[model samples]
Target: MKFNATLLAQFFHFILLLIFLRIVAYKPVANMLKSRQEFITNNVAAAEEDRKQAEALRQQYLADMQKAREEAQAIIQQATKAGEVQAQEIIEAAKTEANRVKDNALQEIAREKEKAVAELRDQVASLSVLVAGKIINQTITPEIQHGLVQDFIKEAGDLPC
Candidate 1:
């Protein structure tokens, strides 16, 4: 084998060039690409975590909203029941008042009836006495007077007077 100086020199130059490229460009580029990949992976992981947190928050909010709705419905139902009870009590009170008024009216009517009956009896007695006095005054003869007196006594005895 013949060793050539030109080929040896050329070979040395190529090796130096490769070393320079590796030092100046390849290594830095590879490192940059690796860093970029790591950054992208970290970002993806962070995004997934954020998404999971957001989903959890959404579920919690929905649960809270459902609980609030149920509580409101319960409160409304309780209020409705209480209102119904109050209404029933009011109706009962009204009925009681009506009964009392009816009883009072009946009592007043009975009192008035009693007063009317007593007045009628008094008037009848007064008229009967007046008629008897007129008949006795009209009798002037002794015999008629004696007979009239006897009749008046008998009639008066038969009455309440």
Candidate 2:
């Protein structure tokens, strides 16, 4: 085949067009693609950091809840112990009051018994005096009167206190 000058001229033109496209359009498109890739990577890293921070916060909240529960338990125990102590104290106070009342009642009963006995003795003495007066009113000798008085005195002395 005979070489054509027209063919050679078209080939050179095609090569020049390719070099021009590489210098102008290809470089700018590549730079834009690189910038886009960097932006995507940076966003992914930031999201990962935020997720880690959220996890830490969740763990902290759980720990705080546990501490609060423990504190509530301790408070309940203390209140129970205090209630028991107060109950015991109330029981002791009641027992002491009951004993004191019992002692007072016994003492009052003894005093009442003594007072009744004294009253009975006075009554008996008065009756004896009345009987002696009646006897003396009737005619009797002085020696007989003295003897009767002595016997009455001895009997009165023998009465229970």
Candidate 3:
């Protein structure tokens, strides 16, 4: 074969093949590649949106848990305060009852003291009348008996009961 002629023919043939492939397959293959790129971009954007929504939901759940914990603490504090108030009320009631009982006991003691004093006066009066009758051997007038009893009480006034 002649070298120059063969090289020239091969070059012409390579140029024609490039032109035919550009017309037949280049545009379709480039369009397919662009469509695939768009599909990948759309999928990435959707995944990013989903991630953001998941983060928002997680934040909302954390906020709800914090609010619930605060409410529970408030309820516990209220219960503790109520219990303290109840205990204070019970203590006050017990103190009031104790005071009432003490007053009643004091009044009973005073009444008993008065009854004993009255009975002792009666006995002293009877003894004074009997002694007067024995000393004079006569019945004493009521006025004289009264005077003797009064004098005896006066003399005994300085003595302890």
Candidate 4:
């Protein structure tokens, strides 16, 4: 084998170029890659934290909505109960009013019946007096009749006031 000066010089120059590239370009590129990886990892962690917070907020919102629904249902129930009570009270009042009206009608009818009976008794008494006067005119003497008239007047005057 023959050794050449040019080939030896070229080999030395290639090794020196490799050392310069490793110191200047490769090291700086590796550092830049490491910094970019760290930045990406921090961004992913922040996104995960945001997701967890969002999930917690969603659960809280759902709980609040459920509580509100329960409250609304309770209010509706209370309103229904109150309405029923008021309706019952109104029905009771109407029944009471009806009973009172019936009682008043019965009382008025009784009063009217008593008035009719009194009028009928008065008519009967007047008829009896007329018959008795006809009998006295046919049979009694004038002196007897005058004495009876005076006696009837005295008896009527002496009755209770």
Clash pairs, candidate 4, are none
Off by over 4 Å in 2: 1-21, 124-161
- How many pairs collide in each candidate, listed in order? 0, 0, 0, 0
Relative to the unseen true structure, what is the C-alpha lDDT of residue 72 in candidate 2, on a scale of 0 to 100?
A: 96
Segments in model 4 whose C-alpha atoms lie over 4 Å from true places: 1-18, 134-161
Model 1 clashing residue pairs (backbone): none
Tens digits of lDDT, candidate 3, 34-93 = 999999999999999999999999999999999999999999999999999999999999
lDDT of 1 by residue, 1-161 (tens): 89899999999999999999999999999999999999999999999999999999999999999999999999999999999999999999999999999999999999998887787688668757866787777857787768767766776566542
Q: Positional deviation of 52 in candidate 1, in angstroms? A: 0.7
Cα deviation in Å at residue 45, candidate 4?
1.4
Clash pairs, candidate 3, are none
Per-residue alpha-carbon lDDT of model 4 for 1-161, expressed as tens digits?
A: 89999999999999999999999898999999999999999999999999999999999999999999999999999999999999999999999999999999999999998887777667557655864786567778897768667765665555433
Error of 2 at 115 (Å): 2.2
lDDT value for model 2: 0.88
lDDT of 3 at 102: 100
Writing each residue's lDDT as its tens digit, candidate 2 over 115-148 gives 9798767968886887678687877779877877
